[model samples]
Target: MPNALSESRACLPPPHPPEVAKGVILDARHALVHAEQGWMAIADVHFGYEARRRRAGALLPDWGMPQCERVLHELVRDHQPKRLILVGDIMDGSGTVEETLELLKRLTESVKIICVLGNHDRAGLKRGMSMIPSHREGEFLFEHGHLPLSDHEGVIVTGHEHPATHFRDGAGLRLKLPTMVQEQISAKTQRWILPAFSPWAAGGEYTSEHKRLQTWACGKGRVWRV
Candidate 1:
């Protein structure tokens, strides 16, 4: 198994051009290029995941709206992107209707919101929302990473791993650091797997030699510690 720091560095995909068209690749999650839209694309909010677990008697704490609000606020204020693309899993389940609505309301004033549906999102939770399977930006493709694509011709960005790397200190204490994975999908396609923005979420260890990462084509990508 690879150490956390080594694994993190190894998983990072090749760096985007200093200038991609008009946008700069901001971290591995989204691109902040100066375009007609001036947009930032993020994937997998998975809002209300804690609430869903609590409903199942999991006794999770209430960190839903506040956590999401903080991340969203920072991203908007820092980047000032006119458009925000939520790639998928905006809500954990149908049970978090009120919180989800409140979050949407708070975000309406600052930027335009675009959402795609993840596998966990059911029809009942997305009744009136316009959720798409995939979103295209210039030559980039954005999805939730739960589904597979037939081809990889452009940059593919997704979030589902909720990735974290485990590090051991001098005292032999293990710590899991959240991270982002970047790599090439094929000769012509690039892939970026983002760390979950939600504070109340859990993630898999990046160093684990599991089939899941292999399926996502994460074997030798570069990982960025968050």
Candidate 2:
């Protein structure tokens, strides 16, 4: 049986750019950013969400497909990123690889797509990960953050927390916000945890007890609540 750590690690494809960071940059109005390094730093895109939910007989809105692709395409055209680093959970459930590949091919014209598999990306359907190398930096761990990370010497960036925040007035009218998480990889390394890029995907609220707190303790975790 595959352990959770292995399963999580399996979601990351190879790094497309030699330089892990630095490249084209696009700040999506939706409270996220993108890099020309072919990485779209959006959170919780949850592609095929409606289909998955519907397959389970759950009647919800069928709004994820067009909206998700539109945002992705807009970001891509605006930033011209050569790759996409999906922080985690690109799909909502056990998404079909055929569908994913088709969607990816549509998005990836000349760019590469690197996904740091999320809790929802079931093992059986993962295929494109093998195209890119996993664990890019030396001891630079990359995972979905569903498990505790061992103390290491390099930077660590992941998803699975699906961090989002909300602010409210005294009357309790709340406003939803997307957040960008940044942390120091070590004394020399820098880490960034991207929000879910998927619009329809649900997330583990940042304040939840199950949220990963260690990444936030180094005084480097900054939340850009957009």
Candidate 3:
């Protein structure tokens, strides 16, 4: 598998020139911290993914929630952001919504949570979760990329694509890691796509033909442009 991936990578053209996010720092924990705003954001948590699969007859272990809790707790503890933004898709709509809310309640104890609902979150909304379709602050707009975004200026910070990248290590081991994508739409417009935070969500790789785009991969306790 590793050898096949390495060969495929070699056949592709080199990535475009790098673009830097001035005030946003990509977290190794599959989140982004906006230093200027004192806020941290992650997209597509998709909590209860394993439970959803198991309910459909897949014999999976019940480790998804614990893993999600650990990452989120550590992120909140480390960054101590005034607000934690869940860009979208907080629940997979198949598992127990009450269980998901329990974890969210714990998170709210430390920081304010701003949840923008995604397609998978319809159940959460019906259950009375106070979520919005979009959030705007300053020049940034936050939403789940599953819907059509209205015409807007400045940056659109969202997650729905669940961007990712694939590579092979020196030992011929193939790996698929979640990625964050930055698309330069115009001089005044940009789109920041975040990876899914759920450990079980194997996100799809980005394959756009944009001339000005940057892809950052998160894995092994490190985040780097790839």
Candidate 4:
């Protein structure tokens, strides 16, 4: 259950540098801002998901892409950061290649886009989008959490998990929410797993094998740390 204080704080616009970790700011938009580096990152956009499903006779409506674009544009407008990092899985690969490219074009016109390749991003590569293995700045290492990571000195931020948590209210209505997890691997190494930015993403439960990690649930444009 959410308290009045949490609800009210969630309603406010994102703080300029609301530090979640040492240098990370967890925005209400389900994105992370690297405060010192002037960069914003989002994961699992999963563009063209609706179109691909419709092609396969899923009877889905055309709403996901537009909604994602609107939210992305709003983030760019508000922060106007130096770069927008696509953490991974930007494309669905089933269909709608042209639409995804067009969106990238519009986004690049505003800020430089750094694409970190994920398993699903091969389609974008086939279509000629430049992507990198990982992005590193000061103390933050950004990568798609698909493969085993190498040893690094500082915080690791990854997006392939699409982390989520479930909640049941007093009325017995079950709610599944995308979540951000701050995983403390050791005293020296910490990892931040971001939620999927796409509304259609079926997120995986974020569980730790050793112990429980710090989690925050995001819903209705608001975020609550629980």
Using TM-score as the measure, the top candidate is 4
Segments in model 4 whose C-alpha atoms lie over 4 Å from true places = 1-18, 123-127, 210-213
Best by lDDT: 4
Better of 3 and 4 by TM-score: 4
**Which clashing pairs does model 4 show?**
none
* C-alpha lDDT score of every prediction, in listed order: 0.64, 0.54, 0.81, 0.82
Query: For candidate 1, which ten residues in a row score worst on lDDT?
Result: 213-222
Give TM per candidate. Answer: 0.73, 0.66, 0.85, 0.87
Model 2 Cα lDDT, one tens digit per residue, 129-201: 4432233433445666666654666656666666555557979797555544555635655555655666664
Model 4 clash count equals: 0
Residue 136, candidate 3: C-alpha displacement in angstroms: 1.5
List CA RMSD, all candidates.
7.3, 13.2, 6.3, 3.7
**Candidate 4 Cα lDDT to native:** 0.82
Query: What number of clashing residue pairs does each candidate have, in the order they appear?
Result: 12, 20, 0, 0
The worst-scoring run of ten residues by lDDT in candidate 4 lies at 13-22
